[model samples]
Target chain A: MAKKKSESSVSTVPSPASSRAAGVAPSHTDLLRQMLLIRRFEERCAEAYALGKIGGFCHLYIGQEAVGVGAISALRADDYVISSYRDHGQALARGIPPRTIMAELFGRVDGCSKGKGGSMHLFDRNINFLGGHGIVGGHIPLATGVGFAIKYRGGDQVCLCFFGEAAVNNGAFHEALNMAALWKLPVIYLIENNRYGMGTALERASAINDIAERACSYDMPNEVVDGQDVLAVRDAVLRATQRARGEHTPTLLEVRTYRFMGHSMSDAASGTYRTKEELEEYMKRDPIIVLRTTMEKNGEWSDTAMTALDEELKAVAQDAWDFADASAEPAVEALTEDVYVW
Target chain B: MPVVTYRDALNQALQEEMQRDDRVFLMGEEVGVYQGAYKVSKGLLQEFGEMRVVDTPITELGFAGVGVGAAMVGLRPIIEFMTWNFALLAMDQVVNSAAKMLYMSGGQFNIPIVFRGPNGAALQLSAQHSQAWESWLAHIPGLKVVAPGTPYDAKGLLKSAVRDDNPVIVLEGEMLYNTKGEVPAEEYLIPIGKAALKREGEHCSIITHGKMILVALQAADQLTKEGIRVDVLDLLSLRPMDVEAITASVRKTNRAVVLEEGWEIGGIGAQVVDYIQRECFDDLDAPIVRVHQVDVPMPYAKNLERAAKPDVPKTIAAVKKVMYLDQ
Candidate 1:
């Protein structure tokens, strides 16, 4: 695989400049803020995990913040979002508040799922954020069904489905995509190609290198975006959303990015399958750094202002931690609640 | 009252429910153009159009999960497995996705979906295609499992399941589809978690569900000829079982027998026995006995298949054993 040395790729799809011309002016400052919020929140999550405040397979979204922010930034408020277990980034990107998410990770009653669901299963009916399903490739078909319901009721809403590159080899993914394309369901099948399915690399698991190209088998239109470039990610999603709303079509999007941290808190970032040199190579093109540099070149931002915003986001994360610390654990009687509805 | 086949009664339920609610739709491999494998959905595609009466490709897990997802967002999807045997491929979606979605999502989402098809042995279907699924699905916490032996209960209970706010599994007897029974002309729904007395007596209580209810009734007839009058209780639903009705009948008769179409090892009968021992222990006159399928995969030969499954003679034998008449 030819890794891009530059921090950002020049997208062949509509660029950020082209989007501005097309009357879809994206708020770059807000995008950067959202990405930074996720980054800071996850940094705190890592700290809490290390302190044993949070337990059970906590995955940090340190490097892959741009994909969640940019893609989610393109959707309407009514549009739905569903993803795999590594989902705190997507939940934050979907505008679920930091405090409620933190409370959920702490297993408190104030969490989004009322603490019934933990970190991997955050859900909010009000915002249309379906959930972060635990099983790999499990929620893809659920997203397809959301699209099916939308079309059935004669609505224009689109659902964004997220999973890892490793899930492409799973049967559920193929089954969902085939049905979505065949029925022209309005869903965006987004694969965050962070290169590894847990400990194993994609090349060792999947039969082919071009993950998006496999969309050809289902006859679905496909796109590959520079995952670190938030603007590039937004443009690809905007085009796909347009197709979804207008033609009731589904798109397969491959966002190639790198996971700066380990698969989860249990593993080390440097040892085993990935080397320190590889991590260093990817760090130079860090999404946060890339976006800040672009804003600086455009005369829209400065290093001092960026530092202030970073501190503000960190404070917000710190406040969430405080809120989570004081929140009460769920009542024992809640065990039998919500299991059935008549 | 009007006479109807069990298949036609199920079809009437689907048609009536689809007419009542726009959220109700049917999806499976042959539910649309093929009009259902057993013709349970005949004339539905023409009434509701292809979009509602959908024909999915041969992906059980995928389509089953899609039904759960649709149900999450407030669409009532009726996913018909070609048969209960084929549904094995989609058990993960049924059990993991549909069954747990409401509980896992903290009540944020409820899957109002039904998975129905011909279940149990259908004449020499061999080992792979002739298994009963009541015990397997009833064990799940957030799901409702119903198996009706009569056409009236078939139509009524199906309508009830369609309107339910949770996932339900409707296990229709494959052999009972062609059987005819009286059904009401007006709309009615048989509530789940209730048992119906198919036959009344005083000597003993013969408990059963699904197709075994028919064999139990037949045994009751034979026992009556032998001067042993028994009560035949058809357990309509398996999960929220009618414990009150069960204990009431056992208290009156002081003897009981359970007949099921599934295997004996930890089957639905075991749960019934547990409830009996706990609730009606002092009222019993003799030990309870269960009549079930033989502990082996279904055989191919006609004679072997007949011997493997419980018949009227086996049900009678079980009733007699519970009556303290070993002969």
Candidate 2:
């Protein structure tokens, strides 16, 4: 690997705010822009899936956009993030282009993963967005080990692992948390407690109910945050990120939120476990609405400006879809490709 | 030629591979300071330190997932399951995560890892710890399953597995750990998907793997003394099974018997029979006979446990049945 002068000096992140939670704070406009991007990107994904443009299992982050936007907004570019299948928002928030993501959903040759990984499988090493793991609680240990890599390499990088509240009951969750806490690895376990685990209500499914409380068994600091509030979620993640890098301790955060969409494309949102009214009730506290109301109250954004921003994002999303739609399918020869060193 | 036990050959392979490449390391329950309950990873922690040769907490899913991640990030890891029976706990990580990473990642990540340990019944280890999991693992497409019976294949295949660019499950025989055999004194790698011929003959073919290969070989020798020639073929790699080798041998011998130490019901032998029937059914003079372990929970008594699994007598009986020796 050659380290040329141009390549070495070329920083991975453009905005200084993309690095640490340093003195270079992001403007309100930048915050709103990134948040809107994630929201619109996921909305387009859902629509594309409905149009039969996307294939495989698709888990949309429709109502839970702020969880990824706020959490990722608080970290440095060097910090790694490992999340579960509902990761379109995280990928968009982490600066992966909507075009590449859309192409991936379309299984196109131009996709980020070259049509190999569909909805549930996404990876971008350059941005350090590890993957959209299909298996429940599978990537928890991997995130812990990534934190170990940072510490081993003698860097201050932290790893933020995100999983649904359902993963808390898995054996891997317990095993990974114990190891991370025991090693004092710089990792933060974020639980997006959306009150439902694939049609099963959290209250009925989990005996403990409070996922954060599970972290106390490992003697790790646990925090519960309202995931719909962007600033609050950002503040909580920033605090945990600081503790992880500074004190060398792992923290578990229970982000109280809800998903408007079903577990996957095949799942119908309206079902026996949850009512339409419950879904509508969660929509009232939607992360996008919370951010928009906050910005309106502070006079940081106006309805006219918001409308214009929405129009711009709509154009971008439309362009992304068109770009993905026009992209060629992978070659027939590619079917037997990438299995091994062949 | 150097004489080494099957267990020592595996340990030497791990040590040599770890020394040859910094990326290679071992992680399991007591692989580190505990020196492995089986004592296969003895002196590893002292030699490689806690960073490389790690003693993970009793967390099979966690450590296996960690190994998958490490492999994704350019490290070759050998995850030990004290026994393959315990791997049931980490099945998701092995089957869903490690096996599917390359395909799932759209080819961005290839997990060059090996999950190795003892697999079948050795003593009265009983139901929980004595069952063979090769059939279950071989069911998945993205995985490569290897079961080496001899010290030479154990060392060579392990070295190849450590360096190969895919996930492999190396199922070693627990009872054969102390069995000594001659091994070469140079670095060699037996490629995956290659079968080895333990003995050559023309009358009938015996296809088996792992510890069953020894049993089959003994049966072949006994039959040879009785003036009946038997070709003994060791199907080391179970997934990309040496179907061509077995088919070619059966086409020549015109009769075949599949032997396995696992349960007869839906075992690796059943899979081989299906493959052989599809590939060389026309060449068969007699129906393919499969000698497999009795399908039942291995009892806690030594005699019952030995009786439950396929043995030399069972192999000889199956061969005799195929050869029409009763007449």
lDDT of each: 0.89, 0.84
Give the per-residue Cα lDDT of candidate 2 at A239.
97
Best by lDDT: 1
- Which tens-of-lDDT digit does each residue in A1-342 have in candidate 1? 122222122112122223433455567787888888888889889899889888787877889999988998888877899988899999988877788899989888888888888888889897889998988998999999999999999999899998999999989999999999999999999999998898898999989988999899999999998999999998999999999999999999999998999998999886799789988999998998899888888888977877776777777777778778889998999999988996
Off by over 4 Å in 2: A1-24, A265-281
TM-score of each: 0.95, 0.93
**Candidate 1, B67-170: lDDT as tens digits:** 98899888999999988898988888898889887777788888899998878988998999889988999999999999999899999999999999989999
lDDT of 1 at A1: 11
Chain B TM-score (model 2 vs. true structure): 0.98
Q: In candidate 2, residue A118 scores what lDDT?
A: 78
Tens digits of per-residue lDDT, candidate 2, B1-327, equal 999999889988999999998878898989988898788898989998888888888788888887886676667889999888889989998988888877767787788889999998888889898888899998887889999999999999999889888999999978989999998888789988989888999989999999888898889889889888889999999988988898889989988999988887788989988988898888888888998878798898888888888888888888788878756
* lDDT of the structure predicted as candidate 1: 0.89
The fnat of each candidate, in order, is: 0.75, 0.60
List iRMS (one decimal) for every candidate. Answer: 0.8, 1.6
Scored by TM-score, the top model is 1
Sliding window of 10 residues with minimal summed lDDT for model 2 chain B: B66-75
Can you write out model 2's per-residue Cα lDDT over A204-317, one digit (the tens) per residue?
878897779999899999999999887888899999999999987999999999988888878888767888998888899988788878877888878788776666666666
Clashing pairs in 2: none
